[model samples]
Target: MQIDSTNICERLCNKSIRDISWLLNIPRSTVSGIITKWKQLGTTATQSPSGRPRHMTERGQRMLKRTVRRSRQLSAESIAKDLQTPCGLQNSTTTVRRELHGMGSHGREAASKLYITKCNALDAMV
Candidate 1:
């Protein structure tokens, strides 16, 4: 359930955290946290999470896509090795495989050719 900030402000602006908690049916700590966040940020919206950045940039992803499109049969290890060039990303085979899977291009074994019949050579001769 989404909380309407304006509704909460208008209803509980002058109220205690206990009152707000009782009125909203949420925990006192939650109400207090929300009030603290609003006071500091002037908004109740959640901020983007802080964490490690992605290894691949947009340019890197585009380059990877082009490389994959150019040769779908390339192994992930080969791709990783190619990516070690100055113009490409230096990544592990696992990273290449993960990126490929993320892009919806799964690795597949090449299918074998079907056995040829006598008529196949006859048709070719014709």
Candidate 2:
């Protein structure tokens, strides 16, 4: 399903913007933009995004991971505190939560906490 550069060059090099738009089933504006970018940048590739960089370094991320792995039940506030004490990374709880999310670790209640009915039943039996 990939479009070959040589095939595109052969088919679309001489075609008008309207013709390219019709052939590609895309908007004329998009075609024009692509052509303009190609002419100016000499490539149709995406450029690097402009924005503020991440607050966490590789060492900080590793420390976060280690902290999380060491104590799965720890809260974001606690993790942030832990990171700030020994390490000089003054990240907020929200930032720790975000880093945890990026690492594929989502916020989840423990199994024992989730089964309130079971705990209630045991208490009633006692």
Candidate 3:
């Protein structure tokens, strides 16, 4: 259900905040804020939330995509090094991982290097 303030305001003249909220299916707090702003500025809030600020530009993202597409098996560190060397965008390994993940690329799995050293000398005491 879409709420159109213009239509609702036209339908209900001199409606209270609660009335407006109930009719429009919006939060009463939001309606109150709107009414307060309307009283002071004669308009409602219009600001929209922009997504997280981009650390890299569109050109940089394109370059990164190209680099990853060229070498599917490139390590995160290697990719970061390449980016820093050619473009001087020296981002950390974590940042590179995030960028690749954002671009719909799969993260390379790290090979497990677990090792065990038996302590036979310590067992001799038992």
Per-prediction TM-score to the true structure, in the order listed: 0.58, 0.56, 0.57
Superposed by TM-score, candidate 1 places the C-alpha of residue 103 at a distance from the truth, in angstroms, of 2.1
Residue by residue across 1-126, what tens digits does model 1's lDDT show? Answer: 155483358346687778777877878888777777777887788767899887877787778888899988888888888777857577888877888899999977779997789999789899
Residue pairs clashing in model 1 are none
Deviation in Å, model 3, residue 40 alpha carbon: 3.6
Quantify all predictions' global Cα lDDT against the true fold.
0.77, 0.81, 0.74
Per residue, candidate 3 scores C-alpha lDDT tens digits across 11-103 of 358677677777678787766766666667765656667889778777778888999999889898988889998888968878888888988
Candidate 2 stretches with Cα past 4 Å from truth are 1-12, 57-59, 75-78, 84-88, 101-126
- TM-score of model number 1: 0.58
Measured over all alpha carbons after superposition, the RMSD of each candidate to the real structure, in angstroms, is 6.3, 5.8, 8.6
Off by over 4 Å in 3: 1-13, 41-43, 46-52, 108-126
Clash totals in order: 0, 0, 0
Worst-scoring 10-residue span by lDDT in model 2: 1-10
Candidate whose lDDT is highest? 2
lDDT of 2 by residue, 89-120 (tens): 99999899999999999987756655559879
